[model samples]
Target: MTDHNTAEWWRQAAVYQIYPRSFADANGDGIGDIPGIVSRADYLAELGIDAVWLSPFYPSALADGGYDVADYRDVDPRLGTLEDFDRMVAALHARGIRVVVDIVPNHTSDQHAWFQEALAAGRGSAARDRYIFREGTGPDGSLPPSDWVSTFGGAAWERVADGQWYFHHFAVEQPDLNWSNPEVREDFLTTLRFWSDRGVDGFRIDVAHMLTKDFPDPLPSRAELDAMPQDGAHPLLDRDDVHEVYAEWRAVFNSYDPPRTAVAEAWVRTPERRAKYASAESLGQAFNFDLLEADFDAEAFRHIIADNLAQAAATGSSTTWVLSNHDVTRHATRYGLPPLNGRAEKQGAAWVRAGGPEDQLDRETGLRRARAATMLLLGLPGSTYLYQGEELGLHEVADIAADERQDPAFFRGGEYDGLGRDGCRVPLPWSASGESFGFGAGRSHLPQPAWFADAAVEVQAADPSSTLSLYRRALGLRRRLQTDEGLEWVDTGRSDVLRFRRPNGWEVITNFGTSEHEIGEEANRIVLGELRDGRLPGENTVWLALRA
Candidate 1:
C-alpha cells in the first residue's frame, strides 16, 4: 500500500470514483449500499488508488441519479444509515485510501425540507428566500420567468402552485439554491463541517460554477448561452459572485485541522474561466475536462494538455484529469466511434441515437484506444480520476429499454430515444457467470449486456495482459515517477506523435497515426504497456525510462 504522508497528496493522487448504486451489492437487494462498499475495500486498495470519490449517497428521490439531494447530513436508507457511512469511511481509511464525498450545494431535491417548506409556506415568505424563486411573466403568470434553457433540456424555469416560477439549471426536481441568502451559506458551511468532522478527506462540488444567477431580467439570449465570455462575464454562469461563495466555503474547509479540500465540476466557457474555480483563494482543484472532450488526434491532445496545465499554473493549483464520469458517455464506446470532430461535450440522447447503428461498435478497436489513452492520461502531471469499471474496459450498454431508463434528464428532457446515463451506470460484472453476474442476489437495476461476462473481473484478473492488469501496472509505475513536477514537451517533428519527458527521465510517447515507430537502441527503455518488438504501434502509448 502507498504511504499517506504528503500534505499535498491530492496533487498526485489517483482517485477512483464509485457510483454507490452500482459498485457492489452486499445485501440481497439489487442496489449497492455502504456495506457493499465496505466489502470491496480490499479490491480498491489492490487497484492502487490513493482515494475514492463516491457519488452522492445522500437522501434523495433518485431524480437526476441521486444528484438532487434532499439532505446532506444523513445517508439514504437504501444505501445504509449514517453509521454505515462512518464505518465505510473508517474501513477505507484503514486501507490507506482517502474518502471524498459528493456535495450537491448548487441545488436540492424538490422534496427537500427547505424546498417543501418554501412550497407550503407560499410566496413572499422567508422559506422562499433560500432558493431562486421568481414571479412568472405575462398577464396571468402562465409564462416562465426567462427564456433560459435547462442544461438537461427544455425550459430552465419550473412553475409551482404558488404562481411563482423556480429556476433549475438541471432537472425540474432540483431547485437551484440562492447563494445570495446568508442562511443558505451558513447552512452549507454547517454541512461541510458535519461531514469533515465525520472524517471525510475532501469534497467533490457539483455544478460548482452555477450557484449564483442574474435574476429578474436581462438574462442571456439563446445564442449567448452557447458560449460565454472567457473573462467570467456570463450573466448566469461563472459569474464574479460565485467565487465569493467558494471563498466562504474555503474558509469552512480551512477551519479543520488537516484543512479539507475540494474539486469543482464546473464546465465553463474557456480554460481561463474554468481555472478560476481553482484559484489561490477558491477550490483546491477543478476538473480539466478539455482533455476528456478532445478527439483522438495527437495535436488535439497536446494542445489541450498544454492549455490546461497553463490554466492551472495561473491559478496556483494542481490540475485534475478525468476520462469517464457518471455524466457523459464512457470513453470505451466513444473512442470506437468516429473522431469527435471538435465536439467538446456530450451531445445529448438524440445525438447519440442519430450517430450510428449499435451493431457497428468496434469493440476491439475501442478497447485498444482506451488502453492507449489511459496510459497517456496516467503519465501526465496531475491527479487522475478513474470511473468504476473503466479498468474492466466495459462498453456502454446502449440498448436499454425505454421503460428501464432512470435519468431525469432522459424523461424530463423530452427525448424519445432511450438514451441516458443508465448505459454507463450498469451494475458491474464480477464473475463470469451468475445471477446478475455476481452483482447481487436479484437482477441488476439496469440490464447488463450478454458480452459483459467477457469483461468480468474474474475473466480479466487471471489474464496478465487484460485491461485491469494494465491499469494496475500503470498505476503502480505512476506512483514511482516525479509526477507532480512540470513536464517538457519533446519535438518529435511529427504531427501525429506526442512525446513528453517527465522530471525523472520518464518519457511518454503516443502514436496517433496508423504506423509503427521504431525506437533506437540509444534510449535503453523499460516499456510500460506497449512493446511490439521495439516498435510502438499506432493507437498505443509507451512509457520509457531513459538512462541518467
Candidate 2:
C-alpha cells in the first residue's frame, strides 16, 4: 500500500468511468443498475483505480441516451433505487476510491418539473424565466420560434402546442436552463449540493462549457452552426462573459469539505484561448481540444504537451486531458492498433483487428498502444481521465449498422461526423464464457466484442501480463505522488517521443510516432516499469521512478 497523500489526490488518481447501464446486472432486469456497480466495486478496488465516474443515474426520458434529465434528486427506476446509489457510494468510499458523477446543467429533460410548470403556464409565467425563449417565426411559417436547429436534428426553438416558443440547445425535449438567470443558477447550485451532500466527490460536467449560451439572445445563428470549429471558428461558447458562471460553480465546489472537482467540455474555437477557460477562474478543468485534432502525429502530440505546459506556467492554473471519451472512437480505432500476442511491434507494418482465438490475440496486444497512450495521458502535469473499458485494453469495433445507430448527434446534425458515439459508449467486458462474459448469463444490450472473452476481467485478473495489471501498477505508482511536491516537465522533445517528470522522481516516456527513439537514462532508480538504456521501440512506453 502507498503512503497517504490526499493533497495531490488528482495527480495520483486513476479515474474509471462507468456508463451505469452497461457495467453489469445484479438483477435480471435487462438494464444495469446501481446494485450492479456496487457488486463491481470490489472489482474496481482490485483493479487499483482511484475513482469511478458514473455517467448520469438521474431520471430521464432516455432520449439522447439519458442526457435529458427529468428529475435531479431521484434515481431512475430503470437504473435502480436511491438506496442503491447510496450503497454504491458507501462501498466505493470504503475502498479508498472517490465517486464522481456526470452533472448535466445546461439543460434538463422537458419532462422536468420546472419545464412542465413553464409549459403549463405558457409565456409571461414565473417559470418561463427559468429557460431561454426568444420571440420570432419558426423556420417554417407554421412554427413559433426562430431558425436555430436542435442538437437532435431540428430547430433549437420548439413551438409548444400552445403557439409559444421554448428553447432547447441540444434536443427539442431538453429545454435549456437560463444560467443567465440568478434563480436558475441558484437552483443548479443547490442541485450540485444535493449530490455532494450525499457523498459524490466530483463531477465530469456534461456539455459543460455549454451551460451558458447567448443569454438574453438566442443560440448560435444557423450560419454559425454550419461552420467548422477551428482556430478562428465562430465563438459558440467560452465567451469572456460566461466565465462568471463557471466561477460561481467552482465556488460552490469549494464549499465542500474535500473540495470535489468539476471538469468541463469546453471545446472552444482557438487552441490558445481554449486553454484559458480552465485558468481555474470558473472551472477546475476544461477538456483540451488538441487531442481531437485529426492529424494526431507525434509532432502534434509533442506540441500539444508543450503548449499545455506553457499555459500552466503562464496562468499558474493546471491543465487536464483525455485521449478517448464516450463521444469519440477508441484510440485503437482512431490512431493505431495494438500488437498481436504481446510481440515487439515493428514499423511500416499495418495493424489489424485484435481478435481470433483465445491465444491468437488481436493482431496486436493493443497493450503497446494502450501503454503508449496512457503513459502520455498520465505523465502530463495535471489531472487525467479515462473512459470505462480503457483499462481492460478494450477496443470497440464500428459494427453498429445504420439502422442500429441511435445517437441524437446523428439525427440533429448531418454536418456532424457519422454516428461515432454509440461505438465508444459500449458495454464493458467482465467475464469469459461465450454466452455470459459475466455481464449476464445470456444476452446484453449490445453484442460483446470478439476479444472480450480473452480481455475479460476474469481472464486478465489471472494473467500478470494483462493490461489490467499494467494499469494497477501504473495507478498505484501515481498514488505515491505527494501533493506538496511539485511536478516539472522535462523538455526532451524528440519527434518520436513524449516525456515528463512527476513528483518523487517518476518519469514516463511514450513513443508517439512510428520510429523508435532513444530516451535519456533515468537518474533515479529504474523502478516500477522500465526503459532499457533510454530506448523505446515504436509504440512502446516505459515508466520509471528516479532517485534524484
Candidate 3:
C-alpha cells in the first residue's frame, strides 16, 4: 500500500487519465457514468496506477467535450448524483488510488446561471461584469469586438441581442470569465473548497494559463500575434496576471489535511514560462507536451527529455511525461503513418481519414515502437500520465460516420475541420464480442469499429505477449525500480540509440535505427524486453539491471 503521508508522492507516480464518458457504462444507457467508474475500481487498482485524473463530470452541454462547465458544485444528472461521485472517491481510495478531478476555470457554459443572468441583466450591469463583454466594432456594432480568433476556430467574440459581444477562447457556447472580478475569483475558490471537501485529492486545471487576458484597445490579428515573441506576456494567454490566480488556489490546496495538489494544462511556448506554472508557489506540476508533439526519433526524444528535466529542476517541481490524451490521435496509430506535412499540428487525423494507406501504414511496426516508447516512459524519473485504452495498444478509430460525430472542433474550420478528437474518444472494448464490445449492455454513444474486438481487454489479458500483459508486468516492476529521482545519459555512440541509467543501477536502452545493436555490457537480468543473440532489435527497448 502507498503511504499517503509521503512527501511529494506525485513526483514519482504513474497517473492514468480517465475520460469519464467513455470509461464504462453501468446503467446500459450508452453513456459512462460515475457509477460505472465505481464498478471499475478493481480494474484500476490492478493497473497499478497511483492515481486517476478524471475528466470533467460536472453538469455541462459537452460543448468542447465538457470543458464548458455549467455548474461547479453538482454532478450532471445524466452521469450520476453527488452520492455516486462520493462512492467513486471511496472505491478508488479503498484500493490505494488517489482521485484528481478536472477544474475548468478559463470558461463556463452559456447555460450556466451566471451567463444566463449576464444575458438578462443586459449591458454594463454587475451580472455582465462577471464575464468579458464589450461593444462590437464596425457600424452599428455589426462586427466582432476585435480580430481575436477562437482556438477552436471562428471569431472569439459572440454577439447577443443587446448589441454587446462576449469573449470566448473556444466555442460560442463557452464564454470567458473575467478573472479580475472579485465575484468570479471568489466563486472559483468556493468551487475548489467544495471539491476538496468531497475528498478529491487534486485537480487538473484545464487551459490553466488562459484564465487572465489583457486585450488591447486594438487587438492584433491572428497573423500578427503569431509573429510576435511568445516569451513575453500576451494579450489573451500566459499573461503575468494568471500566476496570481494560481497562487490563491495554492493557498486553498494547502488548507487540506494532506495538502491537495494540482497539475496545469498550460501550453506556454517557452520552457521558462512553463516552469512558472509548475513552481512550488503555483500549481504543483504542469504537463510537458514536448514529448507528445515529438517525432518517433531518438535524437528528438533525447532533446525533449533533457529540456523538460532542466525545466523541472529549475522550478523544484516534478516533470510530467505524456504520449497520448483525449485531444490527439493515439501514438500507436501515429507511429504507423508517415510524417505529417503542414498540417502536422492535427496529428495525422486527415491521414486516418484517407484510409491510412495500406502500403504506408505499418501496424506491426507501430505497435512495436509504441511498446518501446512505453518502456522508455516508464523508465523515466518522474510522473507519467497514461491515457485510457493505451494499455491495450488501441489505435485511433478513423471511420466513424459523420452523422454520429460530436467534438465541437469537428464543426469548426481549423486544424479539426475535417476530423476531430472523437476517433480517440471511442469507448473501450472489454469483451471480444458484444454490441458495444462489453462497454455496456446498450450501444455506445460513438461507434466501435470491428477491429476493436481483436484488441479487447479479454483477448489481450490472457496473451503473455499482448500489450495489456506487458503493461501489467511493466507497472508491477516499475514500483520496485523507481527508487532514484534522476538519470544519466549513457553514450551509446550511435545517434539512433538512446541509453539512460538511473542512480539505482537500472538502465533503459532503445534502438530507433534500422538495424540491431549489440548489448556491450553485462547485466544481472533483463526485466522487460528480450535480447536476440545478445542484441536488441530496431524499434525496441529493453530494461536491464547492471551487475554489482
Which candidate ranks first by TM-score, i.e. highest? Answer: 3
lDDT of 1 by residue, 1-548 (tens): 22345667788789999999998988868888899999889889889898999999998899888999998899999999999999999999998899999999889999999999999998889999999898887899898877877877889899998799998888889999988899999999999999999999999999898888666355556676657564565666788788888999999888877789799998787777777788758887998876566667888888888887888788888788887888767787877887667454345334343223467778788888888889988898888999999999987888887799888666766432347678888889988898788888878877888888999988998999899999999988887764545889988777888999887778898888878877666236865855577777898888887655
Candidate 3 residue pairs that clash: none
How much lDDT does each candidate structure score? 0.83, 0.68, 0.87
Candidate 1 lDDT score at position 443: 86
- Assess candidate 2 and give its TM-score to the true structure: 0.85
Q: Give candidate 3 misplaced runs (Cα > 4 Å).
A: 1-5, 340-359, 520-524, 546-548
TM-score of 1: 0.94
Q: Write the per-residue lDDT of candidate 3 for residues 1-548, one digit (tens) a residue.
A: 23334747888889999998898999999998899899889888888888999999999998877788999999988899999999999999899899999999988999999999999999889999999999988979999877878877888899998899999988999999999999999999999999999999999999898898777777787788777765547777788788899999999999988889899999898888898899989998999987666668998999999989988999999899998998877888778877664556554455543225446777888888888999899999889999999999998787887899888877785545556789889999999999999999989999999999999988998899999998888888888778757889999989999999989888899998879999955534678888888889999999997544
Q: Candidate 1, clashing residue pairs?
A: none
lDDT at 334, model 2: 47
Q: How well does candidate 2 score on lDDT at residue 245?
A: 73
TM-score of 3: 0.96
Between candidates 1 and 3, name the one with more favorable TM-score: 3
Q: List ranges where model 2 is wrong by over 4 Å.
A: 1-8, 138-144, 215-221, 224-236, 294-296, 337-367, 411-415, 434-436, 481-494, 513-525, 528-535
Ranking by lDDT: 3, 1, 2
Q: Which of 1 and 3 is ahead in lDDT?
A: 3
